[model samples]
Target: MTTSATTNAAGVATERSSRRRGGLARPTGIPWILPALVVSVGVLYYCIGYTGYLSTLKWDGASPLQLQVGLENYARMFRDPIFWRALGNTALFYVVTFAVQVALGIVLACLLHSRLYLKTLYKVLIFVPVVLAPATTAPVFRQIYAPTGTLNTVLEGIGLGGLAQPWFSNGTFALFIIISVQIWQSTGVVFILYFAAIGQISPEVIEAARIDGAGDIRIITSIIWPSVRGTTIAIAILSAIGSLKTFDIPFLITSGGPTYATEFLGTRIYRISVQYSDVGLGAAFSIVLLLLAIGTAVLIQVGSRTREEKAGV
Candidate 1:
């Protein structure tokens, strides 16, 4: 009996210890959150660090050290007039497009925010441009901008043939055509975002403004503008960033043509990396683009946060 009792006690103790060990094995803390973080860090390191490393090496698309010129690519970039032109063109596109996009988005959002017939249909139709693939749209616009294309046809029929010059051939006009296409394609996205933000404004707030003898214009300028300020800033930032990285439309429509008049940073990088086979220069340009993107993003965040805080106060 004594031997049997001792054996039973030992078995119970072992089972209790096993249960405790199992409970400990199941995660109770930060270890559970580590795998995702490790994966993210690894990805960031590979992309960023690898790019930086490549930028420092003079690779001729075939090998890493066919021509080892330390910082020559970067120095050459400073002396390249075409690079300056591309940078300036990108800035111009950003400024002009951002202004037009914001103005149009605000107007459209306000118009459609009201009771209208077939509101859903209007929304769908307007937002349809935003959903189309960029690649497909670019080539279609290219055809339209051709010398004897539909645009010139309409112009001729309207007795404005004198106004129809070669669209993509003229340096002055090429960037403008590209900008128009971009605005047409991108404004709908801004419209949807602003529209959603406007919907969140309380009807009661508008009613209160009405009771206070405020007109539509006054209400929008005072209440609506102030309320949607965050969204507006966000849209501006996004538009600027998008413009800086613009490649496809310009590449397809103008090919940064008419003497490099519309050569954006993105196109320049592609030319250097692919066309010229200057991997080092391309990598340097890529780094510049990356820095510009990050810096612009940071500025936007700071500006938006500041405005939000002031508005709150």
Candidate 2:
């Protein structure tokens, strides 16, 4: 009997020890995420830190990186009038595009949400641009905006020939035209996002508001806006970042000309680095663009958080 009891106690202790060892061998959340963490750090260092290092050196593409300028590129960039003009253009583009897109998106979403004829067809038509490649669309727009292109033809056909000018050739109109094309291509994305956001809202709540004798404007202002505020904020930030980094359309169309009228940071960087063989200056410009984008995003997030806090959200 004594021997059997001792054997049973030994067996229990061994079982407990094995369980503890198994627990130690099992992976935790940190171990599972370590690979992702390593990759992210490597990418961030290579992209951001390496770019920063390049910005401090005066090196062309084919030559050795020998000249250490130490912020001279940034100093020259700030002193250049072209840089300021590009910055202004970028700011204007973001403000106008963001405001128009948001307003148009909300209006379209609301309209499509209502009982309308051929709603599905309307949605498909509006969303077609979102799926189309920018490379495909930019060339088409370039042709349309040419001196004797479809836009001029339409103006002449409608007896508005006086309003038609050399769209891409004129400095005054080139930036506006680029902004319009950007808006045309990207508004659909914003509209779809807002439409989906609105769809997620509770239908019963809206019906309750209607039953309580709330007007359409009141219902929208008090209910719809509050519910979709987060979506609106997100789209606003994205639009700002995209506008700041705008390149494809403006580059493919105007090439940042009629006399640098449509010059933005993205195009400027390419021109400086590839066209002029000033990689260091280009790196500095890139860093500035990165900072601008980060700043804009941070500002929007802070503003949204503050608004939410004040509203008791």
Candidate 3:
């Protein structure tokens, strides 16, 4: 009986080993991934290749593709003063909006994530703006920023009528007003991201920190921030890219007006392509915008990697 049992056990072990080896040799999921890969490649090639081909031509939308002014459109774009101003505006929007949104988001996320009452209601209210369509929000804000609009009326009612200026008409304040509107609409996204990251942190770790007499600020700085560094980096990159490609609000609200004070590359591209009928110049602008976005994301990724490596993470 003992001999028979020993033989049966040996056979079972060998079968398990063989099954493990087979599983390792044949990886799964490749069949499911090929369709997604094909679709992504097709879309990328169609968009990028067509845009690049159009950039070298000097054809209006109605004309045949006969005139080939290689790189002249790009040259013209670089020499245009409006282009420089738009670029500067894009950078400013990215920097200021990104800083304010992230800071406000972090604060809000921490508050909501804590043991505060009515957390669910606070989260719903904060996140409501994110789900609203831009079409709806843009027009509402336009009216609110109008001379005799809700904002001005409120300011007058509060006995601060002097503080209420033409929010969208003045070149000096148009960009800042637009920036504030963007922050108001999008800060909820950043808050949710940080909130999710904060939730992933171990409760035991936080409890231990509290036991060691670490105050709330110190705990956040020393533990929470480091733990969510990856999320912060991702949000930063996303905010920068979104700011660079900002179009709808600025275009719809101001039409890049008040003497083109709020013009960005996105609006500029639209004006060149659709309004001015200069397809080639618009294509060149699109290419430049694409390159700028890619370069910024790459730089951020490299910086992140360098920091991680230096810290032995």
| lDDT tens readout by residue for model 1, 42-140 | 897678877777777788789735666777778888898988999899989998898998888877888898878998898898899988987889888
lDDT of 3 by residue, 1-313 (tens): 9999999999999999999999999978988998998888788878898898899999888976558899999999999999999999999999998899878888898888788999999999999988988888888888988999999999999999999988877986889878888998899999999999999999899999999999989988999889989998898899878988899889988889899999999999999999999999999999999999999999998999999999999
Candidate 2, position 40, lDDT: 91
- Lowest lDDT sum, 10 consecutive residues, model 1, at 63-72
C-alpha lDDT score of every prediction, in listed order: 0.86, 0.91, 0.91
Q: How close is candidate 2 to the true structure, as a TM-score?
A: 0.90
Indicate the residue-level lDDT of 38 in model 2. Answer: 89
lDDT of 2 at 236: 84
> Which portions of model 3 show Cα errors greater than 4 Å?
1-31
lDDT of candidate 2 over 182-244, digit per residue (tens): 888899999999999999999999999999999878988899888899999999899989988
